[model samples]
Target: MENHEDVDIVIVGAGLAGLTTALALHRLGLRSLVLESSESLRTTGFALTIWTNAWRALDAVGIGDSLRLKSTQMKGFKIASPDTGLFTSEQALDKDGKFKGYESRCVRRKDLLEALVDELPPSTVRYSSKVANIEELDRFKLVHLADGSILKAKVLIGCDGVKSVVAKWLGLGAPVRVGRSAIRGLVEFPNGSGLDPMFHVNFGGGVRFGFVPVDEKSVYWFFTFTPSQVPSYEEDWKENPMKMKQFILSRINKMPQHAQDVVEKTSLSSISIAPLKFRLPWNILFGNIVKDNVTVAGDALHPMTPDIGQGGCSSLEDSVVLGRCLGEAFLNKSNEEDDEFERIKKGLEKYGKERRWRSFSLISVAYCVGFIQESKGILMTYFRKAWFSSYTPSAFLKMANYDCGNLVS
Candidate 1:
């Protein structure tokens, strides 16, 4: 390895969590080296549903307004069964009575990532640098990159996704599969899809189909089902794009005419599959999620099922919380090189204390919701129709009520 370069903090993985952390730290006047495995920034993952809390978090680190300009404001969520066009329940996106006035938006992931990157200094992100190994020392963590360079930092924040090397190094176990898979894509209607601007979902045949009008010209859609075998990686789609495409077509072909139209027009190049995986909530609650100055964030910390659309939202939340904790730690101490290590330990501990129970409870709820929706039993179907439609919206509202607090930077 080349001679090691030391910094105060090193954030692994330049995805949503990593980029947010870097920007948050910068706002706090702290510089970080964000190491990304990909040769360049990710421009994939067509679009994501960002709820009210996420908008606040984005605003905390600066960029909420920019994203707002690029997104189609989602006012409500409609849930119903595909067979019957009748709606079960509709949750309005607002803060009143039981709900907070947090307007959810669906924005393209690539646009958001690019926005986050643009706010950072030119040298903030290092591309083509993957973490091959992590070795923890008494006062510092040594991050070994694939390019034979070493990054030594007083604090190591692992945002490296579900298959995280940093988490493995910290003794956290592998992510648990939720026994389901998703095929998602973005359909372009350069001439406008002529659909109402809202997020909608239909459940039937043990599958969940969802669509959100990201904008007038494009709509984001997904089909989630319990696959016979969950693919280990994104590339393991068992490549016959046509086969996967047809399988998706068969599943959603009978959905609403609008839904069917979106499915049929799914971009073959954009259609992608993913095996849903999550970390055990108990592991985060009772296990070693934090070790001294080394801790994990985002998927590295809590990879929950995306049924509630909170996986990325919670990951983005982590950056704000982690940044605040670290800022307080640094603000409380001197820049004296001697005690910098202790400051990081304190910061990470505070972050762990703040995040543990919140993430655990959310993960449990997400897993339960997924189980409820995916159940094939007639009783379960009745329960879902009678209960889920009414209860879930309130639960999500309670979740949005959470404020990660201001970044104060």
Candidate 2:
């Protein structure tokens, strides 16, 4: 056990949400300590599609330009039928011919993480500091780490992800599984493969496969299937890299040669399975978003399906808005007329009320999209395509253009 170090806020987890919160606090001239369980930063993952709204959030925190250096801008999204190779719907990358005022980009996850880390001062993040328990005292919150070190802070922000200890301590639990499993991978493709730079989603009966260009030479692909049964996490499961690849290929074997060729070239070692799950009472923005002086964000609050690729985006938005709220609280404290603790508490409560509805709505919308994409019936398939074709491009843009800043006020 080590001596406890106090700070304004202590963030648990060093993933996207945690780091973003740390950065946001830094911008507000507040110091935060980020505790990461992993010894080092994560590397080796597929590209992340940062939609326009996310881009704006990143820009607000001052890392947007750095991210742009390592990203590939996406022109738009395409939905196609695997059976006929016909485009069911195609939306332009920008409806007003302006990248919708925020160009969407696909950047490698590691690259983005590294960029954020580089902007922070040394010791801002404490590696291998896994939090085992949290004890909230009247004056301060105590974060008990796995190694027996105790950290006390005025506020504790849990960015610990879906199975969050902080959330559990605050009475939150595992989210409801949506009965789907996602298999994802990043792979290189041979030249002249005819894959478009735009994002692609091809639907088949009960399964959907997707592709997004990560760069000029590499593409990230994923498939979601309606799993008949959920598998328990086991050591043997970790050893099989080919499981996801085999599952995807077997399910989509009857698709066109182009699709099959891509799948055939994918190595099992490059794939990972993510169980699709969602929580109705979004932990960070709803439910117990804040208990006492502690709060949560990102997947720690709302872990939505990746159908819309807004998981990371939503987390970034959370950090920005939370930072703003905290800033306001501090500013109010400077006037000496109001109590600091009460001001901060009221700020967080307002943040929760404003952010909860939108966050849950997005989660629900993504769930619906996933369900429709994986429908088994022929009638459902026809309706899905019909809806897609008839849906206005402006409506799709409006959904993507949703800004968290607008919700904060």
Candidate 3:
């Protein structure tokens, strides 16, 4: 009703998208309350291999220089077949030649999130405040937290992630599992890692194994298996995190010793295991991604398979575009606060139109890539060897070419 406390904006997650959106709004002197469900900021995820497009987004919001110092730039990239111990192809990933030196960085996800939050003022995020219900009103949206407090906001932004409650409330379907499960972990070497600071990936009959150096002392490694060998693993791994580590190691033991070592040194505490999931375009086409002043970003919008590593990068792009739209709308107000809500709704519509196609296309591409990489068979194997070897710089260049537009005045 009219009894709830009001805020200019309410962000329903403290993740990459929410924080970036908040930072973008801050540039225009707009403040938001970020509600995170957990008791504290999430530090569970492993390192991220952020691409140049994402770095561009960071630069737009003013954190590129700070993060660059903490990360290692990938100069080279390689793909190999573990089943045959035969290499497919190897080349420099830096954009010096056709790539134009558009490099990417592998940084700890926690560090990136913390850095984003640090740019905001104290207590911008309210931890332990989970959303239990959301209501749409005539001029505003109501956010009902699990803690029994109700908040009203002129605009509601959802960064709640793949299994997004906001998306659910808006009738968006659950994230679709593309029949692959992944185990990710961070391995640390006290004396410093011996592996090269380059991107390395190995393909198996129906699996994918990869590792990237996050820093001199640690590496983030991940393995994706098709059809998920250990059924019911989602619950089984929850019984004990070590069990998850064992499951990953068991699969990696037969690989080359170096790949084995990456898993062996991986700590049980740093491991994250889950089925790969993506939301289909039909979901976006048929469902309502935005209505009035309510909208979603990040995984809440396009939950893609990591096959192309575009999931997080796309989300960062979303924040930039969304913030620009909202900022521009907020800045050029013709008149009173009474029409501010209308301007916000128009901004949300603009954001949705700008993002809906791009995100759905990315989701489709990543899903197709995942299917090809994880399928088993002689033909598929042969195709991978041939296709990947011919995978040109244009493939990456095409993906990295787009700009998310800078933050509005």
Candidate 4:
């Protein structure tokens, strides 16, 4: 055990949460080691909808303007139930709009990850380093890797996704599957997609689809539907990208022609699918998210349905908040190592406390929205229509308008 390596802070899973956490710490004059299981950065998600809240976090970390140049600003969004031919649209902002800070964009996941990677110090992320198990080392954490090596850290933050190993170690409950799955793909148009900058969404017949232009030449799209909706839906679709794309196209046959074309034009390599899962809000509210100096952030802390599109945005917020808390603890620490550990522990506890309610609120709202959107029963249909009818633009944008504060405190 004495031969093991040591670090001041260790972040697991180099996805959005992990990278942002490392960058946030770096911005505060702190160094952190990030361990990624992948051979390189994992940027598999074709793209993500970065709302204004995420933009605030990015700006805090000093990468917002650079990322902003890579994507187009969304004008607003439109919702339609093609089954009933009902449509509604709302503006998100204007030249002098009231919602000045509430902007949105569809950023390529690869570009976002690379932007964070560029700002980080060289060799900050160790690729292909998979954690096999974790053990308590008195005042620190001992992380065992599959390659038969041990690394210890004073503080450990889990940014791993929904099935996070660190979350499981902290005794957090598993995420619950909502009996639905979504498929996403990136489509390119040499002549440009000719679509409005506004986000377009359609839902009906137990299928939901949405598309937004990532840029002039590329469009990002997603389709979510109950697994049972397809009479011949096979497990093979999960492993076969071509099978998955065809199945998605089949379900959205009744959607607008442009929507259908987007799916048809998507290359097989750009498509990915997964089952939707969420940790119960109550579980997060009462779970052991923080144990000593070890805690989880992002999806590891609150894996909710993507109905509200905060999955990535909230993770960015977590990095900013967690960095601020830990930065404060470390900067004001005493010389005693034990005192340092204690301060770090208290910082994690503060992070958990601050994020618990916010995580719960987000999970609850996203779950309810997905439930209403996906429900197909006659009674639920009535309820869904009623809810959407009264759903104001302000209410829809309320969650995205939150500010997670700065990393510098």
How do the predictions measure up, each by TM-score? 0.93, 0.89, 0.93, 0.94
Indicate which candidate wins on lDDT.
4
lDDT tens string, model 4, 340-380? Answer: 88889889899999999999998999877777777777877
The C-alpha lDDT values of all candidates are 0.83, 0.75, 0.81, 0.86
Residue-level lDDT of model 1, residues 1-409, one tens digit each, is 3489998889999999999999998998989999988889988889888887888899999999998888788777787665574455677765345554667788899988999999998999999998988886667788888888898888888999999888898889899888888889999987899887767887656788889999888899988888763344344456557677776667766556777788788778978788789998778978888888889999999999877888888988999999998887777665566476677777789899989998998899888877887778778888877777677666665676677877763
- Considering every candidate listed, which one attains the maximal TM-score? 4
Candidate 2 lDDT over residue span 99-127, tens digit each: 44756777888888888888888889999
Per-residue lDDT, model 2, residue 269, is: 71
Candidate 4 worst ten-residue window by lDDT: 82-91
For residue 342, model 3's alpha carbon misses the true position, in angstroms, by 2.3
Model 1: weakest 10-residue lDDT segment is 228-237
Model 1, position 86: C-alpha lDDT score: 48
**How far is 277's C-alpha from truth in model 1 (Å)?**
0.6
Superposed by TM-score, candidate 1 places the C-alpha of residue 385 at a distance from the truth, in angstroms, of 1.9
Candidate 2 lDDT score relative to the true structure: 0.75
Give the higher-lDDT candidate: 1 or 2: 1
- Which residue pairs collide in model 3, if any? 95-100, 95-101, 96-101
- Tens digits of per-residue lDDT, candidate 3, 245-320, equal 7776676566667767888878777777777888988887767899888889999999988877778888899999
